[model samples]
Target chain A: MFGGYNRRYKHFSPTLGCSMNFHIYFPPSPPSSPSPKFPVLYWLSGLTCTDENFIVKSGAQRAASKEGIALIAPDTSPRGLNVEGEAESWDFGVGAGFYLNATQEKWKNWRMYDYIVKELPNLLAENFPQLDTARHLYLSVSAFAPIGNPVNCPWGQKAFTNYLGGNKADWEEYDATCLVAKFHDVSATILIDQGEDDKFLHNQLLPDKFSEACKKHGVPVLVRLQPGYDHSFFFIATFIDDHILHHAQALNL
Target chain B: MFGGYNRRYKHFSPTLGCSMNFHIYFPPSPPSSPSPKFPVLYWLSGLTCTDENFIVKSGAQRAASKEGIALIAPDTSPRGLNVEGEAESWDFGVGAGFYLNATQEKWKNWRMYDYIVKELPNLLAENFPQLDTARHLYLSVSAFAPIGNPVNCPWGQKAFTNYLGGNKADWEEYDATCLVAKFHDVSATILIDQGEDDKFLHNQLLPDKFSEACKKHGVPVLVRLQPGYDHSFFFIATFIDDHILHHAQALNL
Candidate 1:
């Protein structure tokens, strides 16, 4: 939207040993600049979402265009792997990668952590020269309805058990609440907008626990509990402008 | 989106002889006014669209909320009619109503013109006291990728043949280009934004014919050919703010 191009790309991910699809919203280049390089904002969508959900539903491109930030949305999980029981549940295998590298042998294809952190950036730098991925202002915004404390929730517990075997230590490696304690040197403040009426707020998305963990680590985090909102993309579209402006302010735009 | 509530309502229409579902985006009421009534904007979606498409994909609520205009979206056609070949083609039957009344016996259920122009207004007035449908300022913004001269296009020719029989005279009543010559006393200027790169621009969406007809009838019409755009919700989302603003100005918001 807003004079931006939502370009799709498919690249081989060695981290997951499969082809992955990703979408990037490249804001219209400035008239003055011959080849404009934009700071990137990586949007990690929630469960049951592909790369297209953020591009189509978020309505963030309007602000992203004004702020001169490119948006990158990688697919939630590896597809066409043909792993047993992979396509069974909507919240488990296919669209629910949880952005973690799986430790178990059966679910080795779920290496979204490495895919997002390493391969995707390298791919953007190599292929899309107009994207400024090397800048420190490049920010990543995870889901508002995320599995914040994944080690405690049923959706996370089931996914962790299947993807990382029965090791609790392996599960903590992927949990945001657990990781916040270990790595507390975040540059920008974390902004999370949670819908008050989200059905998964109590069980699946434990943002309260994540907020508590962030407080314990002195990590500046702002968790907004929006009233009368749900976990749907409508909620995202409602607050996406504020999120984009927040990122723009952090990036000193 | 944006603070507005997208509420769905189902009411039995006497015109179509079926229960039809429609959505209304009620802009959050002004703080000073306890019970508010706002001017309405009727958004008629293109082919293969339901009431939900404009609510979900158009991102119009953001502009509607800002402009204090409530949006009403009706379904494209009378669904679940179970006609002999109603469910066969995507372009002809199910989702392609063309917003016209049918004269043929087999397609007698297709009375979208009366449903939109007559029944829906009565339903809104009876049920929704918060909507200002009685006002002359209420505006209707039809599709940007509409079958403007439907009598000449393949999609419209097939649908008209099926819905209204083989009479060429019946098709002229439904075609916008043909109807524009007859109804030239429009209060506000007609604004149509057509995508230059739209695949169906040359064949289906003949805005040129409509513009010519409006000119011949001395109707104030502005047809903008947006470059590098296509016939998708993305194109609509880009220009929806402008449309909303135009309606708001006409309503004296």
Candidate 2:
């Protein structure tokens, strides 16, 4: 929207075994830089959200356009799988992939973790020549009302039981709170904005727990509790510029 | 979203003969202003839009918050009237009031002209004490793909036929292009931004016709033809900052 071209592309995903669509916002090439390619910022949306939510609502493109960064928004989950009772629940199947690789055979198509972490990057590097893959930054691991410590929440319990089976160890593998302690070699400071007025603040989202884990692991993190804000795109839109600027500085733009 | 309170209110409207809903974006009150009331910018949306479209999509709140301007977005047309076949067409019926008073007996409830022009302001001044009614400015009369000379366009013709009893004379009363020549005492320069790539640019919009009429009437106008843009909220979000700044200057903010 802000002097950027937002393009959508559909590609068959080998990981998810279903066709996926992603939206990319390419800012106008910087005339000052010798390199033609722009840095990347990938937005991972939360529950019940597709690739279009961030592209349409976040208002992050204004700052991304100003900083000469490209934004890639991947679909939250595989669609049209027609798995039995997949479309029934808002929290478990379909849009609620939780960005985790499924351990269960029935929910094997819910491999968003591999799709986002491995396949999507390879696809971007191979196909999108205008993107500078080296200078990439993943912002907002999960947008509004993020499951900070998913393994400790009911949402995680329900989705994990269905997708990952009864394995506690497997659930911890996908949990960022647990991963922060295991892989504490993270160089950059993780920035998080949690809305105090969010309905899921105490129940689904436990940002303080993640912050404590990060502190114990010696990983630098900033979790700002925004007052009078809710778990809506409105809250995201308000602070999107600051988040984009944070990424820009981390990318040394 | 942008450090502003977006509040939605519903009140009975005598003009429309139905309950009406309108959204208002109140910027944080300027500490410097002697009077607490803020200058307002009224946004009249086009077809298939309600009070929420601009509130959710345009991202104008950021600019309005910066400019210390309150934004008021009224419903496009009266709702829940239950007139036979009122909900039939997407363009002519429910969402498309054309901001004109209806002359036809069946569509007598569609008095958006009186509602917006006379009743809304009074309602705001009486109910919303925080708004300065005197320093008000109406921006984007018919947001995206505006029917400039509505009397000539097919959309306008159909809408006028049903709402105004197939009379061309009644159509001229609400047509901006037609009214410009009759009441050209506008002191400030009118600014318009039309997407060049909009599908309805030449057919339904007809911006040049409005510009020509404004020229003939000696009313100052600036029509910007935005390239590679289309009839979407993306196009609005791109140039909303410029439009807000223009209004701020005109209001001497």
Output the number of the DockQ-best candidate.
Answer: 1
User: Any runs in candidate 1 off by more than 4 Å, and if so which?
Assistant: A136-143, B137-143
Deviation of model 2 at A55, angstroms:
0.9
Question: What is the C-alpha lDDT profile of model 1 across A41-63, one tens digit per residue?
Answer: 99888788999988888788889
lDDT of 2 by residue, A5-47 (tens): 8999999999999999999999977667655788888888888
Query: Residue A164: error of model 1 in Å?
Result: 1.3
Q: Please report, as a residue range, the 10-residue window in candidate 1 chain B with the lowest summed lDDT.
A: B136-145
Model 1, residue B11: distance off in Å is 2.8
lDDT (10s digit) by residue, model 1, range B1-253: 5777999999777798888899999998888986899888999887888998888888999999998889999999998768888878889777888788888898899989888888898889988999987885334444476678989989889888988889999899999899888888877888888899899999888999998998999987889899989998999999999899988887778
Candidate 1: residue A193 Cα off by (Å): 0.3
Per-model TM-score, in order, reads 0.97, 0.95
Clashing pairs in 1: none
Clashes of each: 0, 0
- What are the per-residue Cα lDDT tens digits for candidate 2 across B72-186? 9999999999999988989977999988888889999999989999999999988888888865445333234568998888988999999998668888988889999898887
